[model samples]
Target: MAATKTRTIEQLVAEYAEPIADAVGLDVDDDDRTLSGFTRLLSDAADMLSPADCTREWLEDAAEALTALGYVDTDTARQAILARVDGLLYEAKSDLESC
Candidate 1:
């Protein structure tokens, strides 16, 4: 059988950075501040949002993390980012299951 690759949370964050930023209405240009902020928020969410830890409260925590990161705090932005977060969490869960 082929070996399974387990991705770290940081790796997952890096993989999903662009989508996460877009979802949060961040403009990641030449400067890295926006990306960095998104990274922090994603990293924070990743820490608590393991497959087994996935829940509505965790989802709310992700929204709160986005707000704390000083991104575009709006209903649309929150919904968009939460969708991305859901994907990220699902991938993380799948990764764990495969392992």
Candidate 2:
């Protein structure tokens, strides 16, 4: 039997960051920035989701990485990033729930 591949949140975030940034007309120089922004957004979202949620840790780690990378600051900026991330997360969750 072949092992199924499971993608880490970081990996998934890295994969989608640029397209997301571009979709919203945000200029992201690299995957790092996108990852950071995604992380910050995820962290904020995690607070609203239950601990049993898989996204909890992913969001927190991504936010921490973004903070370390100097990508996030100020409540307004953080909220903006979170809004975008949340949108993506919601879509993903909906898709998963339907499956």
Candidate 3:
């Protein structure tokens, strides 16, 4: 019998993070602090999201963490970043609703 390889949380997160950013026009750099924060947030959110544990508080956490990175300076950028985070959550939320 062949054994199947299981992916770790980090590997799974790496799969979705960049594509999610790309979807919302977020140009995330590896060295960018905002990107670092976002990556951490995504990994944290993964456990809650994988089984579709959707909650406003989770979304808020993401927004708060991203905001704390000090990247979203203007109202416009704030909105954009939140929207992107929401977009990622929305995917999880939608999956929850469907199941």
Q: Which stretches of model 3 miss by more than 4 angstroms? A: 1-42, 48-69
The list of candidate 1 runs beyond 4 A from truth reads: 1-69
lDDT per residue (tens digit) for residues 7-61 in model 3: 3224423554565444333454554234555555454445344344554345445
lDDT agreement of model 3 with the native? 0.49
Error of 2 at 58 (Å): 0.6
* Per-candidate clash tally: 0, 2, 0
Q: Where is the poorest 10-residue window by lDDT in model 2?
A: 19-28
Candidate 1: tens digits of C-alpha lDDT, residues 33-95: 343554555554445444565442443454455454356567565455555555655554444
TM-scores for every predicted model: 0.33, 0.34, 0.35
lDDT at position 31, candidate 2? 44
Worst 10 residues of 1 by lDDT: 26-35
Whole-model lDDT per candidate: 0.48, 0.50, 0.49
Root-mean-square deviation of each candidate, in angstroms? 13.5, 11.6, 13.3
Candidate 1 lDDT score relative to the true structure: 0.48
Question: Can you write out model 2's per-residue Cα lDDT over 45-71, one digit (the tens) per residue?
Answer: 556556775555544544554454455
Question: Among these predicted structures, which one has the highest lDDT?
Answer: 2
